[model samples]
Target: MLLGDVAHLRTGDKGDISQISVIAYDPADFPLIAREVTVARVLRHLSGVAVRAATRHELPDLGALNFVLEGALNGGVTRSLALDAHGKALGAQLLDLPLDGDAES
Candidate 1:
């Protein structure tokens, strides 16, 4: 199943680190999100970006998972040449990360 089918994304950044939170639309879908939205998967999905490290933080009570990707900015926002320097672009791109089949549903 597509991740967008179960959850939505929110993103922000500080220095060269990008943080993304995947929040389930319904608590029922948290299980699927927890199982599929992994650090390895996110790294692969965002392979184009030079991510130095990634950490996944679970917020079961919020039905969400937060990923902290380090060195994702290429450089600090002011120093980076990427068009969307503050990481606004990554959030939308991240939504396309694939989920295997419809098993999670």
Candidate 2:
């Protein structure tokens, strides 16, 4: 199964940094997301992009996982020549990450 099967994605950016927020549509799936969506896994999934580091922040109350990525904007909107310099597509890309466990039906 895929991460997107159980959760939704939202993205944000600042300078050379970016954020990917993975929120579970159902509260029951939060624990599964927390286990499968680790910093290492996210970094690996985003290996095609130039990112310095990744960190996972848990928002238990909100049932979400926020991953803050550093040096991932290709030098941000002002510097990057890429069409989508804001990295809006990154969240969609991350949705392809494989889910490691049986994350609900």
Scored by CA lDDT, what does every candidate get? 0.85, 0.86
lDDT of 2 by residue, 26-61 (tens): 989999999988888888787878888888899999
Q: What TM-score would you give candidate 1 relative to the actual structure?
A: 0.90
TM-score, one value per model = 0.90, 0.90
RMSD of 2: 3.2
lDDT of 1 by residue, 1-105 (tens): 688877899989999999999999999989888988889888877888899989999999999999998999988787898888566688777777667653422
Output the worst ten-in-a-row residue range by lDDT, candidate 1.
Answer: 96-105
Cα error, candidate 1, residue 29 (Å): 0.4
